[model samples]
Target chain A: MAQKTYAGVTVELTDEGYLVDKNQWNKEMAVEIAQENDITLTAKHFAVIEFLRDKVEKGETLTIRAIGKSGIVDIKGFYELFPGAPLKVATKISGLSKPVSCV
Target chain B: MTEKEEYPLKKVCIICAKGNLEDVYAACVMANGAVMEGIETKVFFTFFGLDAITKKQMNHLHTATVGNPAMRMPNGWAFPSVLGMLPGVEAGVSSIMKKQMEALDIPTIPEFLEMITAGGGELYACKLATDMFKLKKEDLSDEVKDIITVGEFYGLCGGQGTQIIFT
Candidate 1:
């Protein structure tokens, strides 16, 4: 599959889902990917991505839908579009050691 | 651990029936879950279920009386349906139910409606049921996106990869 770049994130779309180079992925990149895929980017989406990225930075593993449910995009859509990608909520990934609350 | 792959369901339709406190709470929880899961969600309220969506009556939604197996009273006591006919009985039941739900961290029907809408779920009023009950649009919650017939609702549901769920 040909690799695509969105906001410096190297992404490749596959039958399973989009694969990204974690080194090149960031919250801005995720938002850009959603936009490219025609998914509406709301404040909630960004919040989740930010949370997920923080977990990764902290060496914590997480899932995307575990993030808060306020986003406009369906959790199903998020998983389908970003398979294997961790979701964050307010700087804390679900499986991460450190817990950060956005409330 | 690796993240589990999630296959997204396209849509969900909720059918709400009027009952006691538990029934109302169940409807709200299901609807909220659908919206959270990213399915396009719609809720259809009929009969007593309509009270949960009514502007003024929503906060005062009550428990059903008589022949309902789900109802329970203190000390294994059961109330008769005849008592339900008395004025303020419904209100009393509703208030108690509300208090219980609040303790359980469940939001009220109006709050649930707001959560669903804020999460991008659609809200509709049943046309035939509304007309049958002499309910006007003004009587419904302000969040209602539209008043639609069952056929129209089905039309919206008619697409590739959509699922209709009755709660």
Candidate 2:
């Protein structure tokens, strides 16, 4: 685990950089992390991020196709916004743990 | 860290060349898994694998019970090869597998494709295979973005950390 400070709040992260205690997350931490990954938060990004957070709360499996059909953002728009790794980056910014389903 | 370990995996291209229900779903599951991990993912349907992407045939895909080493009876017994050759045995086995997957909450093939594509994963059909099978573009699921050649498949995987997995 690694420790990082955001907005004067110290938090734990996994070796892969996912948040350890999701309760420690806030919009400010999300913004900092997004900035670290070269993304600037926008209304569109928030829409997807908030949806991901909600899905986590409900214990739902998030898939690319599911997100695409969510009517939140189409698949093309998702890739355009997140670029390199949409699901990973979006979930990280949303303050979720690293996905265990993908192998 | 060594140079070899420094470069992170950036993309994954999975080539599905078999049409068997289990084989095609295995490719779909992996491709979907890659996308779930936030890796750029692409699945190429080639040869008989095209059956998975073809609209008319995708849902009708069947498990290959003949000589399948992994098949097992529900009673925790080994499924015999001789019995597997019975006329209805293949369908029975396929239905059993599908039921097991459903019990585990795994998505169906079309649903899996929907999930993968929604998550920003790319789907493609092989140009040669499509032509050889005389399949028109309309024959494939709308998720298939394009029909491309094997060289083009490798081209998409040209990035330093890109992985090409054949199934």
Residue-by-residue lDDT tens digits, candidate 1, A12-62? 644323443455555566566565445555665565556565656876544
lDDT string, candidate 1, B1-167, tens digits: 99998756777788786744667678778776666555677887877788778897887666666565655565567777777768887677768767876665466778778767766677888898899889999999988888888898888787656777665
Native-vs-model 2 lDDT? Answer: 0.84
Please provide, for model 2 over A17-48, each residue's C-alpha lDDT reduced to its tens digit, 9 standing for 90 to 100: 99998889999898999998999999999999
* Superposed Cα deviation of residue B140, candidate 1 (Å): 1.2
**lDDT of residue B107 for candidate 2:** 76
- Native-referenced DockQ of model 1: 0.07
Q: What are the root-mean-square deviations of the candidates from the true structure over C-alphas? A: 8.6, 3.3
Model 1, position B27, has a per-residue lDDT of: 76
Q: Write the per-residue lDDT of candidate 2 for residues B25-101, one digit (tens) a residue.
A: 88988897777667889999999999999999888888866687877888878888999899998888888888887
Candidate 1 share of real interface contacts = 0.00
Off by over 4 Å in 2: A58-81, B1-5, B36-42, B102-105, B114-122, B148-159
Best by DockQ: 2
lDDT of model 1, residue A53: 58
> What is the alpha-carbon interface RMSD for each candidate?
8.2, 3.9
